[model samples]
Target: MNADEVLAIYNDLAAENVPVWIDGGWCVDALLGKQTREHADLDIAVAREHAERLRELFARWGYQPQPRQDATDWNYVVATGSGSTVDVHVFEFDDEGNNTYGIEYPKDSLTGTGVIAGRKVRCIAAEWMFRFKTAYTPQDKDLEDVRALGERYGFKVPATHRRPAPRL
Candidate 1:
């Protein structure tokens, strides 16, 4: 997803008062306040209470549910006929900031603020974003993302992910 499409969805959702926090690759770019690469989908974290309303809005915008192998009731993707997609991650946070449902995003992980296309946006915190990207067996894109975050946030990129993605 490009910045314009991502922003359009974010603004529309804001218009409806359904809050969301950007995650994944877009979150990296958001935290950096600029686009670094092309994205296949926009990932967002929403309160479980608003998940249904989020879906309703997408339906009105012509987006349909797109099934994936990892699909779950709280985590799934929706796509438009034009192929733009949003990967929705729903979470229920407890009074103490623990995640009680859906993705295990830490209490402070969603506290980040970023700029996309000059408009400030909520996103995963920089430190948490770095940790999440490196926690997995990274793809080429993940490594690049981690590297960028490292450079920007002063974190050391782990040796395991220091190797560059192989060139075909």
Candidate 2:
């Protein structure tokens, strides 16, 4: 999805009092305070309890639920009748407010909150985003995101990320 569409969706959900955190590439852009590239889908994380409401909202927008993959926390994809899909990650938080095991957000990982295109948003903490991106085998886009985060916020990407050193 493009940035405007992403912002529109967040605004609509916010109007209904649904809380969501931006994740994946858009998330990396959010952390960097701008859109760095085009994104195929929006990645969002919401409290597990809100999954039903999210599904309903997307359904109203002409999205249908697709089957979730086995052994992944990803709840489902909301696909437009035209086949465009948005990935939704449903996560349960513990009584202590920790995102449950295998869920992406760690306790205290939401470091910055603000409004983007009039939609309020909470961004994945820079450190955690760096850690999360590093876990996978690096793609060119992933490396670009890591470098952008580092350049913008002085965030250091850990050695575990399979990306080569950022160009000087």
Candidate 3:
């Protein structure tokens, strides 16, 4: 999704009192304070308590749920008629701060605040993004994202992700 669409959704959800945290590649761009590439879809993390509200919002916007091989009740995707999609990750935390359900998102990982299109937005923290980017075998975009984060914030990137230059 493009920034305007993403922001519109964010604003709409906010108006309904459903908080959403931007995640994945769009999040990287949020942290970078600009859009680095075209985003195919938006990734968002919301509290489990808000999933129903989120679903209703999506339904109202003509976003149909897309079946997925790995979708759990707490995580799934919805796509609009225009091909804009959103990957929704629902999460919960215990009183002691442990992840109790859905994605294993630590509370601190959500502390990041960044700007998108000149508006402040909540996103996954850079350190957590760095760890997530390096946690698995990365695609070229992931490598580029990690390298960009490393270059911008002085995070330690794995040796393999230190690309010599961008691929043509």
Candidate 4:
């Protein structure tokens, strides 16, 4: 998705008062205050209470769930006929801020805000994104994002995130 499209989606969610925390690659770009790469889809985390409402909202926009073998109640992708898709991760928190259902996102991970196209929006924090990216063997894009995020935020990029030289 492009920046405008991202902002448009954010605007719509905001208009409907749907709380969403931007996640995945888009979250990294949002934290950086710029778009670093083209995004295939937007990722967002929402409170479990709002999941059904979100589905209804997207239904108005003609988005339907794209069947995935791994699909679960907590996570899935919704797509429009126009090719735009939003990957939704649902979670719930107890009074003490611990996750109690759906995705096990830590409460602190949702406390970040970033500017996207000059509009401040909620997103996954850079530190959390860094941790998530490094928790697995990094993809080339993950490595690139980690490098950039480390440079911008003064974190140490793990050696495992280093991209190997292309074969000649």
Candidate 5:
């Protein structure tokens, strides 16, 4: 999806008071304060209790539940019948008021907040994104994302997970 479409979706959900945070490639761009690349799908984190509402929202957009292997306690993708997809991650908060559910992101891993198309947006911290990107064998797209983050934010991802860039 393009930035405008991404922003529109987020804005619509925000208007409904859905608590969501941008993640994945689009999230990297959001963290860097710009759109660094094209995204095939949107990634968002929502509270588990809000899943049903999220489903209803997507249903209104012509998206339907797709078969998903439970990767964790709360992660899955829903797709439009035509193939567009949105990856959803469910999270819970700890007593310290830190996000500690689903994937284990350190409390301090939350970096900053910004506005995307006038809507307040939360993004995965740059350091944490770099850490996550490096934790996997870098696909070309991942390498590109790492390079973009480095270029835009001066955050260098280590070469630990370096791999040949994926052929576009």
Candidate 6:
């Protein structure tokens, strides 16, 4: 999705007072204050309490669970039956800031704020974003995000995450 679309989703959630944190590649670009690459979908983190509400909210846009082998009550992709998608990652934490359900997001990791299409957005912190990107056997897209974020944040990307050779 483009930056404007990203902001639209974020703003709609905000208007409903549904707290959401932009995650994945968009989060990296948000933190960097510019688009580093195109995105096929949006990844978001929301409290488990808001998951149902999000489903209801996005339904107006023709979004529904697209289904996947990895789909869970807390994680799944919603789409309009075509084009881009919204990948939702739901999580909850107890009073002491330990994960209790759904995705494992440390409380501190949710404290970041960045701009999308010139509008501020809540997103995963850069340090945690970097940690997450490396905490996987990355695809080429992940490598590009990691490289840009690492350069901007002074983190050293591991050798496994290579810069992709240019496509002709």
* Candidate maximizing lDDT: 1
Q: Candidate 2 clashing pairs?
A: none
Q: Which stretch of 10 consecutive residues in model 4 shows the poorest summed lDDT? A: 157-166
Candidate 4 Cα outliers beyond 4 Å, as residue runs:
165-168
lDDT winner, 1 or 6: 1
Residue 99 error for model 2, in Å?
A: 3.2
lDDT of 6 by residue, 1-168 (tens): 989889989998999989999999899999999988889999999999898899899998788888699999889999876676999999999989899999999999999988888988999999999999999899988888888888899999898997756899
lDDT tens readout by residue for model 5, 1-168? 777777887888888988777888887778767776678898887776777798789899988767766654477777877667788888777788677667566655555565555556877777777777777877778888888777777876677544546899
**Candidate 5 all-Cα RMSD:** 3.6
Q: What is the C-alpha lDDT of each candidate?
A: 0.94, 0.75, 0.92, 0.89, 0.75, 0.91
Report the lDDT tens digits of candidate 1 across residue range 49-95.
Answer: 99999999999999999978999978999999999999999999889
What is the per-residue lDDT of model 3 for residues 25-142, given as tens digits with 9 covering 90 to 100?
9999999999998889999999999999999999999999998999888889999888999999999998998999999998999999887899889999999988888999888899
List the candidates' TM-scores in order. Answer: 0.95, 0.83, 0.95, 0.95, 0.81, 0.93
RMSD to the true structure for each prediction, in A, is 2.2, 3.1, 1.9, 1.5, 3.6, 2.4
Candidate with better TM-score, 2 vs 5: 2
Better of 1 and 5 by TM-score: 1
- lDDT comparing candidate 5 with the true structure: 0.75
Reference-based lDDT, residue 144, model 5: 83
Looking at model 6, residue 69 earns an lDDT score of 98
- C-alpha lDDT (0 to 100) for residue 38 of candidate 3: 87
- The backbone clash count of each candidate, in order, is 1, 0, 0, 0, 1, 0
Model 6 deviation from native, Cα RMSD in Å: 2.4
Task: Report lDDT (Cα) of residue 156, candidate 6.
Answer: 94
Clashing pairs in 6: none
Candidate 2, residue 38: Cα displacement in angstroms equals 1.0
